[model samples]
Target: AVMDFACPGLMGDLTSFRKIYAAPIGKAGERGASEEEKRIGAARRAELGRLTQGFIHARKADEINASLLPPKTEYVVFIRLTPTQEDMYIRALKQKSLQSMLGRCGKSDAEAPTSVLGVIQNLQKLCNAASLVEASDEFDIDASSKL
Candidate 1:
């Protein structure tokens, strides 16, 4: 007998689980899945459920142990961009390279997916710190609005 505890949300889709488990289940309803493949995948899923003894949801665990748990508090603070950071951000958005990568103009197909991802990463870095986007060795802590 096997017992497994998993959060349904974290488990993701069955296809993702199958990939992680390296199971022989074929893609179902995907672009390349034939009728036979779909049938095989469905059969395997059914068999998996049948073989499992039972399923349980410990939904009340937190409620039952409420006294032992500390109260949770969440705070969201908004910070405005620094003058230099704001200028850099506006310039970056207007750049032809970023525009091309985002498929807004120029030859978008000429750029690889990795290139597009790199641009996005750089933009995220820019949001954190202008120095990060510049890849400068000297980081001015005061320049970071979030800091």
Candidate 2:
């Protein structure tokens, strides 16, 4: 199963985020900002023509010079999609049935491959197991209680 999510500001993977936002030398490590520092945290990024950018609003851009090229602070955003959501689309295609159908079609033996028949058997097994697994995960399902 494949799942995907995009957070524009926080695109890409873990390694890249650290590389782009890591503090330079002589900076204090893991140090919370002072009260004066707290005042500085209000800045946000904005585009400023072709050559430059600002992390503060245009109104505040004059105060936040481009010389502050080394960013003063960093923040991160993360997103995740769980296994079921990832699998939902593929699962909708009736994957097990299709697999069995293909397995049967692929057999070239004169008698046809005996293992192709196993595809249907295995598909049934998978469904049975999945139903049991779903039963375990859901208390509201009455079927689980009987077993």
Measured by TM-score, the strongest candidate is 1
lDDT of 1 by residue, 85-139 (tens): 8899899999987776677434555555778778778878887778887867876
RMSD of 2: 23.0
Best by lDDT: 1
Q: Which tens-of-lDDT digit does each residue in 1-147 have in candidate 2? A: 011142244323555434432322112233665644333332211111211323223456746665566656877754332344235334734677555556557556553455555654654443434452233445544333245
What clash pairs does model 2 have? Answer: 44-55
- TM-scores for every candidate against the unseen true structure: 0.50, 0.20
Off by over 4 Å in 2: 1-107, 110-112, 131-147
Give the RMSD in angstroms, all C-alphas superposed, for model 1. Answer: 8.8
